[model samples]
Target: MILDVSALLSGKVDVLEFDYIIPLLDEEGEATILPPPDVDFTSGIHICGRITDNAGYMALKASCEIGYRTACARCLTDLEGTFCYEFEKIAAKAGTIEGDEDNYVMITEGRLDLDRDVAEEVSLEFPTRFLCSEECLGLCPKCGKNRNLEPCDCANQKEIDPRLAILQKLLENQ
Candidate 1:
């Protein structure tokens, strides 16, 4: 979605209330457009916020939510969750602000493109690791099986570190 900030830029409007929907995928296809890795956005993002002119600079405050599906990082089970967050940003006319790029966005042609910002915010808010539950048993390294579902014989085997083989030989000689 594109927001025209000409009125705010020109000082004609001090504040603008906005409510819009950002589509997660192309309308014609099932593929995701722009989302964090392994995440499937199941619904359009709903955003509601307001933009105000702060001494010639545009300040934005918004809250958004979207339904998403992903897999558990440990057990690889499908999980569903909602991505939600509230954000604030200061946008200046292109080339006006300096230093950190993440502090604010650059407005071009008196318009702010929300697509990139929304995607970035969603990615930042997404969890780096997902778990089906706090106490998930995860998978067995020896037999590559899900330990939560069933027990594996590999769990009964003792694993010896290869680096300690010399010590084992010394003990056997004694």
Candidate 2:
């Protein structure tokens, strides 16, 4: 999303409100976990922020919600989720601000491009793992069967640790 800050830059408007939706995509041009495949983001980024000019610096406080789909890490079932994040950013007019590169965005030509910022925020809010349920049985390691569907007869025997096998052999010899 692009915002024209000409009025803010010229001291005409002290604050501006912005709201939009941004589509999230991976490098392969496919819908990513940020927006997921089920959530529709074609309308653009759903953002609402107040842009204010503080002295000569522009500050933006925004919040957004992004819906996405992911697979259960244990059961591999598709699941839908939402990611929400809020950010506050400060920008200076081109070369006017220096230092603290992490906290500042440089506004050039009186325009602010929020595409990258929104993407980053969504990514940061993404869950590291997904689970269909708290008690997901996952899959059987030996048979590759989903334990949640049905119980497998695979032996529940615990293999002896290799390091302790030598002691077992010594005991058998004695």
Top candidate, metric lDDT: 1
Q: Model 2 Cα displacement at 100 (Å)? A: 3.1
**Candidate 2 CA-lDDT value:** 0.69
Clashing pairs in 1: none
* C-alpha positional error of residue 66 in candidate 1 after TM-score superposition, expressed in Å: 2.9
Q: Per-residue lDDT of 88-145 in model 1, one digit per residue for the tens? A: 8887878977788786867899898776677677767867667888877666655557
Q: What would you estimate as the lDDT of candidate 1?
A: 0.76
Q: Residue 167 lDDT in model 1?
A: 46
lDDT by residue (36-109, candidate 2, tens digit) is 33333333346788888888767888997766567777767777766677888886667876676667666779
Go through the candidates in order and give each one's C-alpha lDDT: 0.76, 0.69
Candidate 2 displacement at residue 97 in angstroms: 2.2
The true-versus-predicted C-alpha distance at residue 46 of model 1, in Å, is 2.9
Worst 10-residue lDDT window, candidate 1: 165-174
